[model samples]
Target chain A: MNMREYRLGVSHGLPVGMGYFSVSFGFGAMAVSQGLKVWEATLISLTNLTSAGQFAGLTVIVAGATILEMILTQLIINSRYALMSLALSQRMGQRIGVFPRILIAFFNTDEIFALAMARHEPLTVPYLLGLGTLPILGWTGGTLCGALAGSVLPVSIRNALGVMLYGMFIAIVVPPAKREREILAAVGLALVCSSLFAWLPVLQKVSAGISIVLCTLVSACICAAVFPVKEEAAV
Target chain B: MNILLYILAMALTTYLIRVLPLTIFRKPIRSRYLRSVLYYVPYTCLTAMTFPAILSSTTSLVSGAAALAVAVFLAYRGKSLIVVALSSSAAVLAAEAVMRLAGLL
Candidate 1:
């Protein structure tokens, strides 16, 4: 990587790391509260980095569900990442190295993807490798601290703190929404689908992960058909 | 032996699911349809997790009801999600207080 890209990567890593801290901490605390050992909780946040999949998997574990259910749940919840990775490959530089791509792909997420894509230059493998590392480190570190201090923290505090991950998510969503007005429709569509899934009895039995997959799929299909960009203003 | 293998397999499969796709699909994929799907994925995923927890927390529905209203207001008004989240949580906690005083869960 060039010196400039390396510097930029490190600088970008800070906000991403700080942003990730609370979300990972919450994950760790939740895992520990759910009866996992600290190391297991730490490992989960480090490895998965996906709140929805891990949470769904944890639920399956608690219920003693079969492996088929476990596999299906994780697959459904994480399927969206494939789409994100696809969007990213377009931005990859010529002759992007395989190892970093392989390693960083494991940690691919909304925030890191946004940061990588925001660059003026091509998103090279080294730059992404450097960028993806610290954010995940902060997350796993947060998980460890939260798990270690799981019980000492008061319930009310935990209740309030649990919402920060949602905040981080909104931060990621709002920027793109501003760039493209079609996003408003997308949000509305997704929300309506979610509400239907939650309220309608026929759909309520669908596992939460499956519900997400179905809702996202249906919402995206509807929004794409109804709210195509005006040809000149792509997001 | 079986349980240990299950855990090991879970870890391996999870890693493979995450990394394997990128290895194959190295070309630039220009599917606006799929990007739209990814954009909405977060909301659906968040709702899937939060909807059940927030709903189950209240019995009488007054507090959770109020909290939902507050959350929607804050989010719509361009207030930060943190602010919206705080106000809604406060609403629920306060609602719980009232319900406790009134002998409800």
Candidate 2:
């Protein structure tokens, strides 16, 4: 746990923290629009540490979905992180015992995962901690700032900011979709299915949590079957 | 009360998903099919979360759709995430301002 290495890791984390600040700002504003108070929204960000899971959970909550629905939605949406954690665990080496591993797991956002995996050597606890610190603060701080702004902003402006969440979603999906045929097909299918869930009478009655789970599973299954990625690229 | 419970359940669920694998899986899972499925999860989830809802999220469907178009285009052109978000939000705000002035909002 060298201090110099820890400092370097934290410095590398600064950009991810900056990016998270803007994205979570949108999340906070959207959460407020959905009726959560500033503190509640920030609390969710602090606890969840996930973008899609938090967003989906907020949707479920706003829709007045039940507790079972909330749990299931988060499980399905965030299960990908389990895979990431598995990949990371294999890389961080065995000196990392149970407690530090658990701590690192909590901090393993997508950006952190990428940065840690890119390292040529096995990761250390302090370095991982250093990487986690700023992003955590940035995420929660962004939520707090945005939620406060949401509460104070005029109605029209708050409504305008609501689109930012969707904008962030686009920023996440578009680059990959544009580059990969399989992803494009899967996303297109998901969009069509989601629209039906929203507009079709019988499907419209389906809970938001159920609809998201259904759409994600169905689309992912279809892509996994039809476009089974080649072995090397699957990783 | 219910929101608090929901957030707690969500945090618990998310934490377990992340920690279980880190604790349990010392070796990478070898199944290609399963890995591919995991790879597709974010794409499907984000896409499902984005659409139809985005259409209704803004002050008007027209403004929302216009902003979405701008977002997709900018992203396809390789814009960074923050840039794409800022530009798309700017597009929506600008479009809404026009719509409001025209008494169309």
Best by DockQ: 2
Cα lDDT computed for each candidate against the true fold: 0.63, 0.87
Model 1 CA deviation exceeding 4 Å by range: A1-7, A170-182, A200-203, A228-235, B1-21, B30-39, B57-105
* Model 2: per-residue Cα lDDT over A149-212, one tens digit each: 9888876677667777677789889988988899999999999999999999989989888999
Q: After superposition, how far is residue A214 of candidate 1 from its true place, in Å?
A: 2.9
Residue pairs in collision within model 2: none
- The residue-by-residue lDDT of candidate 2 on B50-99, one tens digit each, is 88888788778888898899999998888987888888888888888889
Which RMSD values do the candidates have, in order? Answer: 4.2, 1.4
Docking class of 1: acceptable
Question: In Å, what is the interface RMSD of model 2?
Answer: 1.3
